[model samples]
Target chain A: MASFRSSLPVYATTLDVVWHYAFRTICGAILVFLVAPILVIIPLSFNAESFFSFTSGMVSLKPEAYSLKWYRDIFTNGMGAPEAAFGWSWLVDSWRHGQWMLALRNSVVVGVASTLVATALGTLASVGLSRPEMPFRGLIMGLLISPMIVPIIITATGLFFFFSSVGLAQTYLGLILAHALLGTPFVVITVTATLTSFDRSLMRAAANLGASPLRAFFSVQAPLILPGVISGALFAFVTSFDEVVVVLFLAEPDQRTIPRQMWSGLREQVSPTILAVATILVLISLAMLGSLEMLRRRVERLKTETPI
Target chain B: MTAVELGTEGLERRLARAERRGKLRAFLLVAPLLAFVLLSFAMPILTLVRQAAYNTLVSANLPETTALIADWKVDAPVPEPLCEALVREMHAAKEVDPAIPSRIATFVNRERAGSLSRVKQVANADIKAPYCAGLAALHDDWAQPDIWRALKIVAPSFSPRFFLQALDFRLQADGSIRSQDSNEALHLMLFRRTLLVAAGVTLACALLGFPVAYLLAHVSLRVSNMLLIIVLLPFWTSLLVRTTAWIALLQQNGVVNDTLVALHIIGEKGRLEMMYNMFATLVVMTHVLLPFMILPLFSVMKGINPNFTRAALSLGATPSTAFWKVYFPQTIPGLGAGCLLVFILAVGYYITPALVGGQSGQLISNIIAFHMQKTLNWPLAAAIGTILLAGVLLLYWLYSRLVGIDKMKLG
Candidate 1:
């Protein structure tokens, strides 16, 4: 692979070689540091025992030292009867009664709804922003993005007071609204990036063909920017899915999302089931990252292929 | 329709009309979100500001005394009328709700300690009008201007007392502001530590991230793309998961300690108490936020014309000089954005510190949450929030200056 050494001068001094290799070592260590913790949890989640550390048996590669009980516990921890024969009723019992399952449902409901709201609103706003005729572009953008930069604690405090007053506190609708507001900035940034780099001539061509503005957008623009919209929606979904502070402030016990559940469980006890949940969440994020990378490459390819 | 109007003026008028329509169309697209954010996000923050600024407990319950003492000098002898009104109000509040006086006392106790009993005593007593002498005889706190001044300070619906307390200062009996004693300076201390940790984290991230970002930028496209995943994976991972991972790594009997013990670097009984301290907070936070530093620097470094540095080197500059003078300055804007962004996020971070930050590791955000949740002191939390909000917004302004708001990206 081509690295710094590839670009180094032939007449490089001993000092240059030492610095180049030293830089490489530091960068390598940083990458390992960044990834090791997340990777370590994957194997730890499969540990036979409840202890957080690697056991001697597991370290010695004993096959019997690993187990799937924690993963199973994610579904059966709060189930009414785990001893019930493994039948349809047992599946139904776990699905309906499991604490983690309920949290997962809440997370998905809130994540999907908020992502939809944020993506819809943000896509429109980005469209408006991309227009040369838009007014107060900078100010509007600054305002939209302010929700992100403002401390979540402040936002949570404000919302707690305001929502309780207007009767929005502790409700799914209130949470959705809050998460939507938090997610919009991501949608706006991604969609706007896509829109600005968008080819205006195609829209002009469609308009010249007697298509209305909306028709032009649907026919000539949406396909090219669909990847951007998907990426933005993914970000919004992940944000709401992973969010904890607002959930901590706004959610009732029934409305606890995954992060909120993990928070309580963590505070109460260091259960391996939380590790199981973390590992699952990590997998979901990996999937999200994979898709986003693909979309990024597609966008890059389009930008290059389209000659100005 | 245009048959009769075919001149330059008509064409210009038509163009102006088209422009207006375009502008309106654009605004209409943005109107829904603008309204949504204004109502949901902006309004709640405004409510928080009101919470921080207004205290209704004193003004509502102690209305008569608050009004009577409105003009009373703090250092003046406790007026008999003021004392009488105060006692009457206290006794009346005792009649309506026995807890009101003590509640007021507890509320005031935050301002001046040893107040819980004083206000409770007056409320419980049968002191009558010309109650000043009797009140003073009952308790010296009644005669002193300090309690009266405390009441005066809390009397108004609008007050700076919460803000003062948040900043570790207090309004005195005579209305002069004094910084609190060291033992009372928790909020001020948290604010300082928050800033210190933020700066320290920013520096640490720059040191750790600069080289990796340089590698990503300098490497071939394929290799760089492969390495970029390492940064993006952490960025995409759930924050709590990352924090939990750190706990597992740094706990006393956890991986790092176990590895150290096995390697004989530390004895079995000497396992490090790395978790629940400033060390855990710093390491975990730096791990979580490093991607933010790397992505921006990599993006900036990738755009630099390599020839600029080569040109410097060709001009007989030493390798270090060429790198520093030519290469380093170019990365400043990126470095600035990354540092400021990390600092802003770090100052407001609650989860990592809350989970890993044992006593000494708590930041302003943690204390704010503590007040909000455990202490049930919403007004004080809101006050700390106001200060944090101001500092963050200032950084945001600088951030927006360094990189346009529209340019904020995700990997």
Candidate 2:
């Protein structure tokens, strides 16, 4: 198409080619602007020096200009003596003292726990919501999903006071509940979407075959909807993992997640270690994005392949 | 009645019962989550709103004093009975909870600044008969009608003082609401700034996003999907990481400045202070929210039949004219949804601004957080939060009306 447009003498006027190139140029620049910040951090995270910008040697692509020190720092950052010779004791010390490691643990724990809660409740409610017999489905769904729409700051402040009065503030339970509340919307949206395309007669058929509703769900429905469920769970987990506002209000210093840790790190001190963490997070998001894309394709395929 | 009619009636009753049972089962399935959301999300916001108009620290601690001053005229001097009630209440409160006077002082200070010490001083002063005169002797502020008026306003356990303060209004000594002094008016300005920044970011995102979305929509499926991934990658990345990337890029010693310096756009000594200002906030936010704009726009543009524009062009119209007359109008729904979504998200934005929003860039959310955590002033925080929440909910209501919330998609 490009060659055809450029090859035609009369069709390819100077004005037309200039305008076409200009439009493409602007689009290209905007796309680059969208992804540049994320891409820039990857190479900067590999800088041997602790600076945020590329060093002269690095600009010249010197082999010695890059190092894994920051990535290594992710593990050894808080060790009592990180310079100590490599040994099992150093590894133990790093594991015990590394702040990022602790934050990683907290992130995973909160993410998984909240994802489980959100997925279970959201999936169940979506099932009921998808039913033709369900009452006030729109209003109910709206209320359930308001957490996603409401400004998170308002939610955080509200939860702060509520949790304090109920003795849940500054506890893992408080953080987990807050995250699960935030995450539930994703689960509800995804599971409800999957349910929309579902065939009700399958369940009715299973019932006619003397299968209990639970048995029918596990055998006939769950398998078909598992992609949506897993993808929703992944989203819920990411929501929890990436969340920081609620953590700032509700989490204790001991309960800090990776984002919360990066927050203070960025504020109180700008460190290259943050770049390392950011790189890892970018990679994680890439993996998540890939999985989601795959799951979407799978759901589409399943929808097309099903006779119903 | 015939046996057939009787049997048909019985079957109808059984079917009705079965329908009711199914409805009950569906309700039960939804019940647990409904209860959880109500308990966790809905109830918390309600409590926050309640907190805005609820003030109890002063009244609860000095009940007798509040009652004594409730009917006192503003023009009159501090009555002996009020002073006596205050002293008695203070002593009693100290006996019950040593922290009560301080709490009362804090609450009073919120109304009339610098009066807390006077309250503390009077609370500790030894008074011999003639209570009003003795209190006046202990602290000259005790003789002032303004202190009395401030106390009276908050004397009620439930008062709208915080809400009034949130709007930069205050109760005068004569008990009339008026605008706060210019020097003290912060929240109203913060609210305006928040709205302005949100609008700016929304406009910027729209401008930057429209072209990219148009390109993506016009491209082949494989190319568009790959570009969509490029857009979604940042959308999926941790927000803090993106904000951090901006900081690295925009800081004085960061990549942008370094590049500019190398290119002689600005000398080393003249490096721009870019990181901690509104520019940085707007730039970072637009980047963060661009995907939101693009996705909706892309979806809408993809759905738009290209034939409309082509047909217009084929008939007598130029490409530009056809685009304006046909393509642009069709994308309004997407444009509206994206703009509102970005604006809503931008207004409530806390983390990005907090990280990079130095003094000038901070929004209302930061102030809400400041009061909630730093100042320990929950009521004021609640008031600010209520206002921000109201604005967001209004926009959301509009968005849902214009473009159903059901159509809102996330990668």
Candidate 3:
């Protein structure tokens, strides 16, 4: 195929090559445009000065021009005594008083709690949904996934009234349930996709071998689909971690997550600390993307290697 | 009957029972999630929609007053009995909760602004015998028939007042609806602008995403996969971070302007105001939502048999003709899916526009947030939410019809 493509017909001319180059160039530029803004913040986050733009010293590659001040400020900004000697007490003070630290704690707690709920519920539902015997599957699936399709504002407003009435508003549990609802759709989609190619006969084979249905699922299905489940959980975690709209309406001051904190920071005050946060978030996303990619490749490999 | 027939009948019955149990087991597995979603997700939205058309704020607090006012003629003077009921309810409510009268006043003021203080003044006034005269003495505006008419309109326990208001209409005392005055007709215009912006963003995504998707689809798998990661990076990035990046690049003293100034594209003093406006919203949204468009298009385009275009060209059709007739026609499903997805997402965009969208750029979502948080007007917020939800569901239905919801994928 490569040789056939290289030995083009006489009709294939320089104009075709030029058009191909132009198309590739446009695509490359668009990709750069997509990734550039994300990369732009990294250097700006490290700037010794608080400005968004690069200083001449930084452009000239002066080692003195860059500092970790903003990154340090992520922890030390709200500390009682930044000038205090580095010790456990200073760390404790930062943990207690730092805005970003509080947000980080809230984000992890909410993200993990929501991801757990979403993954459990979503995985079970996908198992049932993928079953041929499931009833009202289309309508039920649509309703289950509508959280992703519905506008966050509507969901938030609805949740605000409902949660306020139920005494869930401004509470950690309320935010957890709300984030879980939003994250479930991703879990459902990813897991469902994995199950589409899944062979059902393996379960029957295990059952014939005297394994109970639950045991069969654990031994036969779960191991094979573990990559999908983990990826789905990761997606759920990301959804909850990055979520802000619902949190804006539902969370109290103490429950503010990283994205929620960044929202207020960007809106009320534009600070280099937010850029530092953004850079950190970018790194987190990079890690997530890397893992998702690995899981996807593993799933593909598993699908091919295993037979019914 | 033979013994063999009896055994076969028993076996068939047992098999039927097992099948039923299997179905039940499957349903039971899904039931918990369905129930959780129903309580947490569906019920709240239903409550919001219901609240839009149902408010008991006035009727609940001022029950006797509301009842008495309902019997009065629209153009008639404030009846003496109605004034007595009002005074009775105010004193009674004041004893129960000090904020009740003020809450009722605020509720009434929603129908007719500036009536709260007038109502408050009456509630505060010391009254002698013949309470109507004393009420009129407390506030001169009390004697006007329109104030009384406004009270009657909002006095209903179940009212379409918020929904009407959301639609840019006012409910009159005569049980008729009329268009709101020009100054108050904000929602309809906002809804129109929201649709326009969503449509514009969809078009922009399609225009920009098509080439990239085409390149990804036609390239070697190794190259495409590498490029796909670049596209997915922003898709996975935090929305706030992306919006902040836009702010850094687009703000007056940000990188873009600085670069332009150094290159002498424009004078340093004439740095463009580019951050907070409709243009910025569109540009940034297109950037943020482009991946949504690209991914779907790429998936579909990748599935297209390249042989069709080759065959068309071999049949002596021009390359453009082959693309237009053969390749482009096949990509319509992807186009439809991508456009609908982008438009639906754009319609509900809150954070991006909130950060970058200034006055003119603001969508209906922003206004909904404003009412929910700022104005403390829950009914109006609910009403706006209901309309936005209706629009989204309609588009969603169309999308599911065009591209099955089950087929939707995320990175």
lDDT of 1 by residue, A170-219 (tens): 99999999999999999999999999889788989899999998899897
Model 3 agreement with the true structure over B1-411: per-residue lDDT tens digits: 999999999999999998888788888988988999999999999999988888776788788888888888887678888988887778777778888778878877877888998877656777775888887788877778777887898788788888888889999897899999998899999999999999999998999899999989877899899999999999999999999999999998899998898889999799998989998999899999999999999999999999999999999999999999999999999998999999999999998889999887899999999998899998999998998999899999888888998889986
TM-score per candidate, chains pooled: 0.94, 0.96, 0.97
Better of 1 and 3 by TM-score: 3
lDDT of 2 by residue, A1-308 (tens): 56646534465667877777789999999989989999999999999998999888899999899999999989987778898988998888887889988899899999999999999999998889888888887778778878988989999989988998899999999999999999999998888888889999999999999999999999999999898899889989999999999999899999999999999999898889999999999999999999999999999898889673
lDDT of 1 by residue, B1-411 (tens): 375667777889999999999999999999999999999999999999899999787778778888888888877787777888888888888888988888888777777778889989988988865789988889888778777777787778888878998999887766789998888789977899999999999999999999999999999999999999988999999999998898889999899999999899999999899999998889999999999999889999999999999998899998889999999999998898899899999999898899999998999999989999997878899999998999999899888887878667777
Better of 1 and 2 by lDDT: 1
lDDT of each: 0.90, 0.89, 0.90
**Candidate 3 clashes between residue pairs 3 or more apart in a chain or in different chains:** none
- Better candidate number, 2 or 3, judged by lDDT: 3
lDDT value for model 2: 0.89
- Per-prediction DockQ comes to 0.82, 0.78, 0.83
Task: Tell me the docking grade of candidate 1.
Answer: high
User: In each prediction, how many residue pairs overlap at the backbone (N, C-alpha, C within less than 3 A)?
Assistant: 0, 0, 0
